[model samples]
Target: MDVDPAASAKVVGNMPPNISVCILSHNYAHFLRQAVESCLAQEPGDYRLEEIVVLDDGSTDRTLEVCAEFGSRIRVIPLPHRGFAATLTESVRHCRGDWVAFLDADDWFAPAKLRTASGYLRTGAMLVQHWEHVVDGDGSPLLPDPHPGGNTSTIIVDRAAALKLLPVTNEKFFHVLDDLGLGARMTHPLTFYRVHGDNMTDRATPGAHQEYMADVCGEIAVRLADLRITPPPWASRSALRRLTWHYRAEARAHEVEAALQRGRRRSAWGPLLRELASTVLAGRNYRDRGPSIHSVLTGRPCVRLAPSPQEEP
Candidate 1:
């Protein structure tokens, strides 16, 4: 297809000042169209959105065609599968606006989101986030009202500030850790969060918590060092508790494996038993724990290890 030159020019010329919209996607064709249209539907003339950069993280679906339909209004950047962190960094690096906002392919924006957030653009505030309307798989409202949670829809950050704190999104350690510290370091009062079943933040299991713990511990370590706070006694105590849990978790895992070996019927107990086993097996020294299952379930990675599950063997 011959590219439209005039459309291309319009895309380049009407750059919104101070804010760029960046979308990261992978195989989200079904929802990608709505996401793009929602951003385009923002109150016209209310905000000069500089650019719309969609980082296609090696999507095999028709996501590219859907984005192309927007003409030159959105720039599609293709990337190898570097996971979430790296792809985000690419979008950030390519962003021309002073402020950067994010949208996932499977998610979208509220009509007034950008207009509402325009009040807080400055050099000092690293981020400006706000409440989001929760929805179901079909995009119907699930929550009665907006809630304070961290989804791309709820994120608007100072581009330079983010770069200074952490340069590369490809580094899993950097993205996960910085997100927690960054949230703690700043006050956010902008954007709307839309919760849906397909939303990335909704998926979590107790068994997956080891990954979550690792991310939090990593971020807390960075924050503590940044603030020059000595490690508290609870940190060490927690470490021991995790280690003890690891062995018991391993033992329980062995029991579950034995059960499976004996070919028991697969049911609620079967899944529960396996989940517990995975949680234990996943347990690493406190230092290695990354983002928590709660963070995975919730949009933001809040570090609170609820009482470790009872030891089973």
Candidate 2:
């Protein structure tokens, strides 16, 4: 991303790690102010705040006017109406901080968010994600899930890594974490998520997450011609029932059922569409004899355990 050195912040001998915060907005002008102010109020503990900018993606609302409200403190970038991933690509091009933080126009950061991120800056992780407090339009607390979704608004990524990936889509990202480096999960000191009736979670159909995982597994299968390895016990029938215990992967369930239908190991994923349709009609449970789709397809370990005394010679 040829980060125009003239525009990026230069760190001298004793300066702390610096970060650029990017707020992605698309007509959420009503919520823009608090979002920007929340970032401005961040307590830069071990890091320095390089800049704060709004990547406005063709908002017909008074988004520019909102940025203008902050005077020179906030930089407003106006771009054509591209989708979120594409706008994220532009956001990387505009950042000068050593690290880049993302926030949704509908979300805001906690006071300690960046400070918490600074502690993890040297941990060699490509991204550091924290928890989120979900609230309604009135700013009242709503019951949040036990774990954060590792949403964009909760993430601060290494600028270089982000640039290399481009498009910046997290949808298939964590699914392919083996290709990228490590990602961290910070349990405390959260960011904020507002559910203004139109939240994506509210609109998504049931089993969406699991369906996505299944599709990702299927994609990995097609890309991999050399994925040869023995799946561990967890990929076996004995451990298969634990599927939903981890995450509700509806599509993975389908793949497992397909494998069970085949009754053998497959080199890669394929359209089990016909068999899948039959299974849904026949009422089958995929957990009984399903292999770990990730392990079988990606050839990555699902779990590592020490050799038991009974097996150690």
Candidate 3:
């Protein structure tokens, strides 16, 4: 929760923030309080918190009651269940701030998260994200997030830029890895990303997740080609190659899981061996750090290498 005073001062300057925070929730009433309180706790000095909006996507739980608990302090938008991208686009449309920061109902921000991010955004950066601390359901620290950018909770984006990139429909392109196309990454750990059994990403069958992710990568490539923009360091060929390895690893892992479920323990070895060979050929993207091939194959949380530091603008 401690922010470097020098770094804070450098971004904040004398300008007040014109920011809106949007929280997306669906059947997350259990964790909604903590997420809302975290936003309410932001101390941005002259920077205005402006509005905190919670878009409840047709929760059949106590989520609405939770929003009502805050009363007039925040804006609550109750809508029928629309999937992630549509809900996000709808929430963005409701925001009136110059900057928008998204927090998933299951995730919470660190103290001074908004203060620091707003300062950086004021410097004209199109997007800014901080490091994420991945944790378990009980809030125990699991590991430092290796892939920090593009997560909805970790990023703050310019309103104009977001509107252009995030679409209400045909949104798969902007769903999970959208941040790669946005802007810069900050090295500070400013958000807590909770990994639990109920998470949508975690709930997806491994094979389905892998296929969806591969499609996402292809879309990104197409978008980059169309725009004639160079891929950022994190999304370059090496990064995509690393992602490809993980996809293949996850697919093989799923095969092993199926074998074990069928009580064919010996059958798992063939896929496991193929996975090992792929890992050996992946080459290292980080010194002694690479994709968590074992974790993918075992249905455990996959650890990734942290992004390399980039020169600040």
- The TM-score of candidate 1 is 0.59
lDDT of 2 by residue, 1-313 (tens): 1122223243233456689999999888889999999999998597889999899999999889999989989888999988676777788889899888989898888888888777666555566777788676766666545336467788787776565444444433432231233455567646887767544341223333434456644444332211213222213322222321222233445454334333433522443333334334434454532445544454332323322222221
**TM-scores of the models, in the given order?**
0.59, 0.64, 0.64
Model 3: runs farther than 4 Å from truth?
1-14, 144-149, 168-182, 219-313
Residue 232 shift from truth in candidate 2, angstroms: 29
- The window of 10 residues in a row where model 3 has the poorest summed lDDT is 304-313
CA lDDT of each prediction against the hidden true structure: 0.54, 0.61, 0.65
Candidate 2 Cα errors over 4 Å, as ranges: 1-15, 144-146, 171-181, 200-203, 206-313
Tens digits of per-residue lDDT for model 1, 56-122: 9898889889988999988889888777767777777888988788887777776776776664342
How many clashing pairs in candidate 3? 1
| TM-score between candidate 2 and the true structure | 0.64
Ranking by lDDT: 3, 2, 1
Q: What is the lDDT, from 0 to 100, of the residue 255 in candidate 2?
A: 50
Model 3 compared with the native: what TM-score?
Answer: 0.64
Q: How accurate is candidate 2 locally (lDDT)?
A: 0.61
